[model samples]
Target chain A: MSLALSLAPLAYVACPECDLLLNPVVPEPGDKAYCPRCGYLLQRPRKRSIERTLALSLTGLILIVPANLLPMVGIKIFGNSQDGNLWTGVSALFKEDMWAVAVLVLLSSVLLPLVNLGLAFLIGFHLFMHKANNQLARWMHWYEHLNEWAMLEVYALGIIVACVKLAGMAELRFGLGLFAFIGLLIVNAMLSNELDCYFFWQRIAQLTKK
Target chain B: MLKKPLKTAFMQGFIRCHDCGSLLKSDPKCLCPVCGHHVSARKPNSVQYTLALIISALCLYIPANIFPIMSVTQLGVAETHTIVGGIVALIQSDMVPIALLVLIASILVPLMKLLGLSLLLLCVHYRWQVNARLFTRLYRVIAFVGRWSMLDIFMISILVALVDLRGVAQVIAGPAATAFAGVVVLTMLAAKSFDPRLIWDHQLSYE
Candidate 1:
């Protein structure tokens, strides 16, 4: 309930890698702390962590609309032009009875990134305003776990692979959505990089505990 | 079995919550104060789950490569392509860079992950006295590259969606697409279930 209580507790840190208990290094903003025993990245406290995460997640949220809904690429084959949007890929898999891959694509490419961005935005927005939300801790927990599954960058590469494979068969045209999808990928990458777990957890623990 | 080290948190009555990274009293039944998630000293059945998943992926590895991933029909002619076949076609068509990309993502990465996790499992099972640090590095690499294997599955999905002009040209998912997706997911889970701490434990002298 005091001002100093907002700081992260540094009693000890167990490396997620080797579980070697050591005195936690309280890195300054923009500095990183690494595990002494197993070289796991212990912490990286970035400057303006909350604000930057909020901005990037907001940008990603906006881009998601155009990225997934609009046609990402158009193919011209023998005077026949067909456009492929993100949803069509999942639906196409389902049509071919590849439901497993369909769900995987849906979960990893579309749904998980949406969840990650939404959770991050919620967490970041509330934290920036210094507002108390009971769900902040839960949001942060899921955010960390689901971050790995949000594979926008990998899907971007998949888009590249798809274009490469089809280039000889058809004339490929880059659509506005492809650029927006790339923007979303870049924003998500930046947001993931900018996230400071130790700082956010400390802030949440401080906010909710009182 | 190696003697438990006194320096680590597990032996010193502190269990870090994997979810929120909070250091707490070492109790198997306690939920994390911040996240309300179970706190464990290590991933339960780490070696067994990793070994089982890796073996399962290896089994799927065969069908994933042999079965055609996609069948493309253009102008009343149909040709099926397995993963290797697709890469070879790409190479023959002077697309070596894309061929290499597919070769790496579809075949090499999964093979490396399966082998690396198996070696780590063997190391922990035998308590192999080797450089724990290097093995830990290997574990990190396996974990990082696990997601990229999905590159092929996503490509097929896009191809299936983009090339749907009936009779003129169409690409339909083959049986291998499902199995290939399985290999990627299982290997990722295998890597996740493994505890790198087990590697460092072998460095401790037997009591």
Candidate 2:
């Protein structure tokens, strides 16, 4: 092994879960190193992670347009058919003077997910280009914060629950947006789990050094 | 000093940055060299911030449960449902699994979070030295499940969107949806503001 490769194992890592100090043995591609004390994922550096995440993020971003534009569900009640998109619900809440719910929906369902996916794309692009600058680092930080607040999966579950509740009262039909939203949720989740922060920082450090 | 020796990063004069997981020399006001995040041996004012957030969430919890979350208007007869009432409606409609899911996600999880956080805060305040490991696990559970409490709010949004039929039927979000969302957000913020390391800090001090 090269001197640098050998010395890389000397870096100390503290388990975020149990605070156990450990020297991690870097795993091979497709393997994961879990903290022995608390089973917190220590590191898992996948080959071409940036490329894979970038592709997934792009797919999610593409799906978002339809998810927001097309009606999420079609409803027929008393021989009257109506179709409503995600924004329709948001506007309906606002019309009812439920400002807080409207804002929450707009933020969690609409804004945060887009921003999160956008950040993922940006970070992936930067990493792939070997441009490890301070701005990229800052964006990565913002990405971490935004990831916590983006509740697309929760929102998707909510749609399912709504459909179940409304099935008895109305002739319900799933829209194209429903499947698109589901696609977005799955893609976004895969991208999130594939992102290993420690590996990203290490990659950035390598790039900055060169 | 009549105390058992303990091994800790703090005792070795090092602290880990909560944001980027970088280890640095212990300093109350130092910025993390790697991530530019503020570094401290412990999160500054963790208890106070957590307490304030918990109290705010608790205050919102009442109105969230009492007032209507959504109203379903069918044929000019509008029926409103609160959080519990909504669950009851689901049960009446034979959506037993969804009702249970909502009961757990919307109600039980948030309630557990509030109670769990308060217990952790009190334990830290009183310096209770029992089951630190268990409480740490509890904190992890609360933090993991905290954001899921938004399920009900999301459901309300979807319902309001899909069930808009003007005069025949319409699902309208109510004031309580706002309050319920507020409770979930506040509890999540409270969980974020809490420093789980404090639980171990007490152990070090007691030793």
Candidate 3:
């Protein structure tokens, strides 16, 4: 039986060598399964994944600060320049009576990631201490819940598409916020990797001396 | 030619015992022309569950395509388009990669999932001989990826909410959001409805 079979309900397997979480694959009888990288038997993630996730998430949270504080996309149409970050766009949407869309964007891009980061922090902290905290499990559950809603990459895609559409009509300007946004994405990806549930669970086990 | 009346003939010959060529009455059950064994047959539920999911998926497919996904607005100009239109816009704007992605995620993938689930369901329902295990595994893979189609929808929603600068430029969402959401929800339901036991109908049940 594969390690995935043991831990599947909690988390998926990330190949230690490649860091790619392998999707389910059929195993042949007597086949010695190993990580796609380094040809070593792939088990669960390491204890440090939670720390890494927390560290990256904290960095992401910090980056998010500047990412929002700075202007995102700048429009210089007819020599009049105006730049808007996420909050501005959200406020604009609300003012225009597109309340539902405003709420969706706000929740998906901002609120959800924040909640995910918070959950990752708590989950990682508890696992590191090797304490069986019910709150940690609850937080982990909440993190999982938030992961799907925070579609930052999708939001980014929408930004690019909107930029393309606006090219002929407006003098579009990329601002510092765009760079920050890219940093947010990279940090978010890294955070997601670091906070993998498998690593947390393993760390918890080790702490418990189980 | 005259035909004679046929008479039913009773077995007059007797069975001979190996010891003495002695005759014995024949047994009622067919004990040994050679040998006898009882045969059993029953199908599994996973097959039926898988089939139900597929059918429901097909039911949602038509609505998913026929419905408009989003409406675009600029300078008092408004136009509605289906999933395909969005992809075309991306392509025309030299965002070919994103365009291909949108096409695959929003259009092709959902259709494939619907079709794949349907095939798996039908095979299980009919006890049709095929790779039951493979189908079961494929079902899981499809279910796992079913949510990713939301990428396009999420993008549209974000844009609609964010780009309302008024008089200069503004964007609004159309009726398509609900329809797209319906597609996602319905497909997910279909994937969930499929049962895995149908795969063993022929092999496990009969044994």
Candidate 4:
């Protein structure tokens, strides 16, 4: 045990799940290293992660404008038609004197996601340009923190549920923005799952060193 | 200290960076050289923060469940439904899968997360020597499944956006939507604040 501890720090990695210290072999491309005791994925570097994430991020960012600007749902009641988009939803909540709810909706549904996607694009762009400065590294760290709070997928699921419930009561017509929002959600999910921060950071480190 | 020593990175004066998987020499004041994230032996005040967050979530859970999550209006008639009421309404309408989804995502998951987190906190506090593995697994499950509770909140947002006929039919988000969102967010914070290392801390004590 003492001999193992005496080895170089780089030789060991602790399992985040079980806290079991194990020396893991660096897996070749397409392979993964898992926590021996608890099966938690320790490390798995994806091929072309940055490029793929950048493409997905750009797609998500493009969809956000349509998702918020264009009408998400069209409601026809008693031969009168009204189309509501994401921004109108916030205004409606405000009109009802639910300012707190309005703010929450605006933040979770719109602002947070926009900021996250924007940051992702900036980071991807900077890294692609080989501008590995401390500022970009700091932005990468901020991006990690922002990733958890940007709940676009959750919001998408909620929209689906709301659509289903509303279908029974009113003549619900799907709008173009709805599809764009769904596409945004899918692209964001793909971006998140594929982007490996470790590899990205490692690449940044190498570039900065150069 | 008669029992055999367990081989751990902590015991070896090293801590693993949570974000980058880099092993670094333990230094409370230092950041991980690889990822530039703050490295700590364990999350500072993890239990206290988690306990406080969980208590606040528990306080919010009542209102989240009791009040209507959202209201639907059609033809000059308005109907409000609480969390359970919403699920029951869906079930009544024969939308069993969606009903189950709402039930599990909004109601059951949050309640279970609170209970699970509280149990883990208790286990760590009392230094319970039984089933450490099970407790660790419970923590993992709570951490993972807690985020999905936001599904109901998301659904409410969508409903409010899509259903707007002015006079014929409209959907307005209720007070419960905010409270429910609070519960979900708080529980997620609670899970984040909790240090699973505390569970292992007791193992050394037992030795």
Candidate 5:
């Protein structure tokens, strides 16, 4: 219950069921640890978490450029056709006096993704080159810090809402951009799986020690 | 046959007290009541988790508003609604509870949870100089309820899937949905990134 001051390198002691961390322990292969509090399994992470994460992050960065530039969806209505991209949607909201909503849209969809990608690139680049940078560490902290604002599911909900309303009047078409956007979502999730900040930092600690 | 009986007896033989490992007991308490060293259990990333949860929640909060949450089409012309519009439509339809629930699940809950997580993380990250137990307990409560943020997203997805009017009433997802989903996920990650032991680090240092 007291605050401990020793900044020892953290370990991978986590509850399996709930994914909470446990105290550091040395375990034999196949030995299991459980959190009495949350009943989660605790153990060292898979060795490949970083490489897999880096690969996914790279892929995400590549796809994001096109996802933003391409029209996500198009609508044709009453002899007037319109093409929409991510930024235009929010701008249109501003034009319609929905400035608050437009700002939210831009932050979550645009800013958050950009931040996440930027963090991944920096972290991945540093880790790959076998260098340790405190600035990179801070960026990792910030990346984790701002990650909460990137709400893909809520964005998905917004898409549904838009589709529902647009359907009532316009001829909507699902554009390649939209498909790519969906692809971005899935790939983002994949990248998260591949990267574990704890594991990455733990490895950094080991290398720095050397 | 004799050898078999001997092996079986050895296998089933009771030595000391099972509970305390005292001495061979004939028939009393079979369980260990002495040392009480039953396996200890607890959350692995209890403190760090709350941090991640809160951070992601904050990010989701922004996009949950910025873009039009839903777009409506009338006679080939399209209009869009932000998160507020969805709430307004619910209010207009006389579904106050549902509207309120949407507002909470879609907006308020995620925000509150994120904010709560940030406070908790700040304490833990800063080494819990004050009220460590009280704050940690509060964090547990907040982390427990973080998933409800998904309700609004689910509502939108189900509505999109179920209410299709083809050319007349087709429903599509909006940019905000992706952003919102990202917030939920990112906050969860942030919560995961926290090192709860940071709190106890100070305590152990004093010792």
Candidate 6:
């Protein structure tokens, strides 16, 4: 526990879920503090969370290209073959004038995830390099709100469901993009676990205190 | 009381950053000194906003299920599949496990969302002195499972994108795709807008 954090009754923490007030405690490194009333995770002390999250976010960014552009799955029937990548789904929907659905798919599956990773990268980069400006807060705030809308893991499940449905109808082929996507999903999952938002907010406040 | 010395931070004159969870002294001009985002005692009109979104989602749920979600065209024949129709097709083909997954993800999850949110809204509206803690957990469950409803939409997109061997066998998204997506998105928004804290306020009042 840092001296700053140990002075707790001065800054009572409220549970976001259930409105329970608590005196802040310094959880052991990588341990969580949950609301006694509703079990909402108050915060956790992640060890070097910024560095790890930055690496995962960068990995996610690198995986995004192949995950979106390359075929995740292919099907063959009666001597004919067709393969689908993440982009093709949205484009195909657009071609059929299902533009609203296409746009939703594109945003949730592609653009929003990119925004999240990009913002995280930017914030982490600035923080690590000791370069904090007025814009860091805005970016961090945006990142918090936009994080929920990025559904890469859900999209990955959708891919698996799609493959299963097609299994009996034709010969199914797994593509490299599928592996890349799984990697991205793992990265995303770990990124969330490694993230300690309270820590980030404290760090940002310290840097941008000017 | 859920714990000893029961009180909320807001009651203690602390306004937490809604986005970052930083506690700031609650003032007339409440803003998180750390993140500079507005921090309210509670989300204003949370129940009303949640109710509105849930009502709209219930309305869209009809078209989402009524119309064909996608059509598989093969050998000059087109077979359109509604959500239920897809499950039946799968069952007839003896893919019980995948059939059950779709039935749950596409059908049951959305239904649960609509009904669950409505009940939670009712509880908050009435300020019923029911078990707030349980309902809070229910809210968490609903929020967690809500995203899985996108399973069918995604599957359709992939099918439409992948099975395009023209005149041999191709899949195309149908009219219901938009409605289904709307239902999922609206329910998610509703869940996001809801304040679970309200569920406990009444409990605290009774104490």
Q: Give the DockQ of candidate 6.
A: 0.64
lDDT of 6: 0.84
- Candidate number with greatest DockQ: 6
Q: What is the TM-score of chain B in candidate 6?
A: 0.94
The DockQ score of candidate 3 comes to 0.07
Candidate 4 vs 5: which has more lDDT: 4
Q: For model 2, how does the per-residue alpha-carbon lDDT over A105-180 read when each residue is reduced to its tens digit?
A: 8998899999989988988888878677776667778888778799988888887887888788889888898889
Best by lDDT: 1
- List the lowest-lDDT window of 10 residues for candidate 2 chain B: B1-10
Residue-level lDDT of model 5, residues A80-198, one tens digit each, is 56677676756655555545545666777777887797788778877777776655545665676566566655566557555654554567887787877888899887776556554
**Worst 10-residue stretch by lDDT in candidate 5 chain B?**
B1-10
Residues A1-210, candidate 1: write the lDDT tens digits.
Answer: 233244755787788888888886666766677776567888877878888999999999999999998899999999999898889999999987889989999999999999999999999999989898888988998898788787887888898888988888899998999999989988988999898888788888778787
Q: How well is candidate 2 docked (DockQ)?
A: 0.43
lDDT of 5 by residue, B1-207 (tens): 001111111122322221121222233333322222221222245665655556555666677688876665544556677878878976776667666767877787667667767776676656656544455455565554455565555444433443344455444457776667566655655555554434433443221
Candidate 2, B101-174: lDDT as tens digits: 99999899999999999999999999888667678889989999998999988888778777777777888888
DockQ values of all predictions:
0.51, 0.43, 0.07, 0.44, 0.04, 0.64
Ranking by TM-score: 1, 6, 2, 4, 3, 5
User: Model 4 — TM-score against the truth?
Assistant: 0.89
RMSD of each predicted structure: 3.4, 3.7, 17.8, 5.0, 15.6, 2.3
Over 4 Å off in model 3, which ranges?
Answer: A1-44, A78-84, A87-104, A202-210, B1-70, B73-75, B89-96, B123-129, B161-168, B185-207
TM-scores, chain B, all models: 0.93, 0.93, 0.67, 0.91, 0.64, 0.94
Span of ten consecutive residues with least summed lDDT in model 3 chain B: B34-43
Q: How close is candidate 5 to the true structure, as a TM-score?
A: 0.53
- TM score of chain A per candidate: 0.94, 0.90, 0.73, 0.85, 0.78, 0.92
